[model samples]
Target chain A: MKLKKNLALSETGFVFDPSNGNSFATNPIGLSIVKMLKEGKDIELIKKNILNEYLTDANTLEKDIYDFINMLKKLQLNENETSND
Target chain B: MKRKKITVAVTGLNAIDSPGPGVPVIRALKDSTYFDVRIIGLAYESMEPGIYMHDLVSKTYQIPLPSAGKASLLTRLKYIHAQEKIDVIIPNFDAELFNFITLADKLKKEFNIHTFMPSQAQFDERHKANLPEFGKKHGIKIPFSKMVFNVGEIPALKKEFSYPLVVKGKFYDASVAYTPEQAATYFNKIAAKWGLPIIIQEFVIGEELNVTAIGDGMGNTIGAVPMRKQYITDKGKAWSGISIDDEHLMKMTEQLFTSTKWKGGLELEIIKNAKGDYYLIEINPRFPAWVYLAVGCGQNHPEALVKMALGEKVKPYTKYDIGKMFIRYSFDMIVELKEFEKIATMGEL
Candidate 1:
């Protein structure tokens, strides 16, 4: 499903969710992933874009992306789409 | 003349590398209209002049710094086990805060005491690494930082953020760092030394400000005072300060208390960036030092806090006659230079 749903944003890139009342900080790329996730972008598309921009190798990039995505899940921002898989 | 009221003071070392909440608070409660003040110290001879607290206080209980681990702290904790006719147990340091949660109920049974401490969950949230998580969730900006557990976590971190990052403990430890490497080195040393977690934060240079306030258990505010750091010791302690009033800063306290339903005194620190953005640094769930400076300027935050806790209707704090400052310069040295030479061998290898 979607973990990046219903995030809050301020002009200075401050994002919070008043419901859970939690704050998160994102770098430019990380914000892009969150925004894309909010916009319903697929994880595969997000990973490809991150690889093209960052100098990291495929495996390192993939691992970090997965780790970050898992962290989002742990924070309950990620939505599980078990049916889609 | 009326007899003096009984008050209580809690303290730890007031030095650089001590981002503590005790010493200044002790000085504040001493001058209040509350109970005759008695100070319980983890550091000896804190404060200067007719102000060593031993002299100012009606009673004094001095405790040595606890050695690392459970046995040492438990040993020192025994000295204070059943002592003092204490009404309020003020934890001026984080270590004390953690200890008091367990000891609060224990002390209450022994001496009818009440302490203002955050829950275990709240305290875990206030720690350094957890800060980014907290900030990320609450729209707070802590200097962008990373967390480290052991010495091996050092090299994995590279200097991409900026120069002069801060290295601090997860919960109740001093922050130290100038560069990422310095931070890494510090983390490794402390990990080996103390066997705890640490974090590296990007340093944002700005003026440090804190709002100290009391919140009724209900969704209402009682009293709050805003302050600025005047001087910091070599160990990251706020040695001196002054009082100021800002409506926006005061509202943050209101909003935070209303949001968290926080039930005691809390101190919120923020750094005003050059562009005038107030980045949230951290929240300490206790009274701040230089709280007396609030009184000297006609606020008396500690007294207001006491009143609220005692269930008296508290007069809301509003007007502050600015330009009040607390300077921590050389007060008289307690021991002489020759005496320093003599005691230099006390804890030596």
Candidate 2:
């Protein structure tokens, strides 16, 4: 899934949606994931990168990434797309 | 350019649970780039926190309450104007606005003291009891509501409205009644406090949003800033809120001013339902307690109001920084009894 264009992600994990002026604060991993999504990174690539950099089982990481992507969709951070595959 | 020095008198110094717009209005005037303001605090109660905010207010004077009638109010204002050479007076309380609006011309003619306020007709038409007709006249959407003078009308309300509706007082207080008995209970409680003609409104379930704005009396909106409450207190006050970029809210504000030519400062209490329809909940006649949020968002409404009061041309502001947030907090000042005694007895501090 692709993140909305021009979502300002500050270094301190502050996410600002300029379109509606909604602001959110996320943890380091969420920030990185948002950054990666903004860069058009696919879900599998994001999952693989997190897996290589962090210590977590493939099953748990996959579940967490899908959960995070679902949350992004709920928050309207992701553009209209059905494929999280 | 040299800044002009002007003395301004303001009321509603109480900054408690339900705050008055006075302190924030003063703060905005202090931040004005065009005028050097000398703040004269007009208060009804000595314990009003703004009276003791020596850094913000130059001096404080006790004024008679609104129930004392316009003659007493005008007489007190005349005395204060003579002593301070007040350039403008901003009355911030809802109960006192009628007196201020009625006295605006006399205050201007007698002492050359200016006040930017809505006209009497404009003020009368926007009251809670008259809101439905106002919305109809302005082509704005308002929830269905009916005013009842007694609890006997509660039983009949079920025919017109469903349970879990809202029972509101004439001036203040509101509660959701899930049953006819509960509606009667709230009806008596609110009526005992604010008096008769209680309003029962259809409960519009949605996010509550507010727009604080200023109109130039000539049908031009000087500034408008919409915000959503992030945290609300039990008293229904916004403890923390953030500015939002909502074009529809802004358009509604402009249309309101363009239609009514509403002068002075006003706060529009709006509810946007899940279906994306906005219902105008209430129209407050003066600046709200969170007016500083508008200033924070770069509109500086009170500053523009002061300029307009002085007959200066103020162009409508086109932009403001979004995502600015305001968190309200309370502070205790260690003041000696002598300070309170001076204001209570001597009537000036």
Candidate 3:
């Protein structure tokens, strides 16, 4: 998806993706998702990696992960589910 | 129409006494003429508040956080607090929202609360593969993508999708391998944990757009705004954003919302490629914090949500300033640089 380049973030996990001009106050987990997508990781991969890196459950993590992915995609930081993944 | 006190359930890890989104939204609804407002939170940690709750709270209660293994009455006591009259549960996170949706029917019947949530099937529409499913049905242009289950499938995926292809997991999976080797390395380390496949999406170089809206479960739109990201910080929150009012984008979003019959809050993401054609990307089924930025222009959504949930009629949002901006001027500038370097070094920054 088309992402706005005007991003402003803080150490405390505050983020503003300038492409859409939508600002967000994200948790550390949410921050990780943004970083991964920005690094070209697919939404699925980002969710997978985050769960592995953090000490959390699989199911709950998945839902939150899915929610965040939806957030990123809807924010236009990433496109919709076009992956054959 | 059921005439009952409107309830908004806000789930938290524990009863940490602090003024967060829940307090403000609850307080706003408390003043509404439509329904009585009560605050609810999930207890994950100890039961103590760092700060005292406001006097406006009519009643405050803590329901133990529900877990997959433990589904006890205490876990669901918050719903019962309304005593079959609780109307809404606004999950602040994925797990909570999933919980609310899973119990939507039961809550409606037992509590007489009209919960507007995406169905279990509808939840898939918001997954990583969500856009593809939506677009495939309606011909919404999206980038090429590849989803893989096993690491051995990497080479096969590459041949079909290409190098810049993004490796993806299910909805929230983020483990990646830019190359077949990286993908395999990650898979080898994490495969046992996930039962689902991962994906690799074609890296499309383009601009990003963010849209936020509140709907009444019908085609008519309530509070809404289209934003162009202006300033972004290192932590990934929109440090600053400017609201954009575009008809073409709004029209496209309207059609999708109507088709989905989406209720509650909604956000649509679209991007324009070099061809200048906008491709459909994703939809968020909740209130985006960034939408709060629109309040200055007369779009106060958190307030609108309170009004709507209270059974108050809201006028459609049709006009707003386009250049309004929000930004985090100073972040860990070094961290920002690192991120910029990561993207730029790869020619993506």
**TM-score per candidate, in order?**
0.64, 0.91, 0.61
What ranges in model 1 sit over 4 Å off? A1-85, B1-4, B7-9, B13-23, B34-52, B62-83, B159-164, B171-180, B190-195, B217-219, B308-313, B333-349
Ranking by TM-score: 2, 1, 3
**Mind giving the per-residue lDDT tens digits that candidate 2 earns over B192-263?**
988899999999997899999999988888899998888899989999988887778889999999999999
Error of 2 at B229 (Å): 1.3
Score chain B of each candidate by TM-score: 0.76, 0.98, 0.72
lDDT of 2: 0.90
Interface RMSD of each: 18.6, 9.0, 9.4
Instruction: Give Cα-based local distance difference scores for all models.
Output: 0.60, 0.90, 0.56
Between 1 and 2, whose TM-score is larger? 2
Kindly report the docking quality category of candidate 2: acceptable
Q: Point out the worst 10-residue segment of candidate 2 chain A by lDDT.
A: A76-85
* Candidate 2 local lDDT, residue B78: 83
**Stretches of candidate 3 exceeding 4 Å from the true structure:** A1-85, B1-7, B12-38, B43-75, B78-87, B169-177, B184-195, B306-313, B327-349
**Cand 1, B chain, TM:** 0.76
Residue A28 lDDT (model 1)? 76
Best-fitting candidate, measured by DockQ? 2
Give lDDT: candidate 2, residue B54: 91
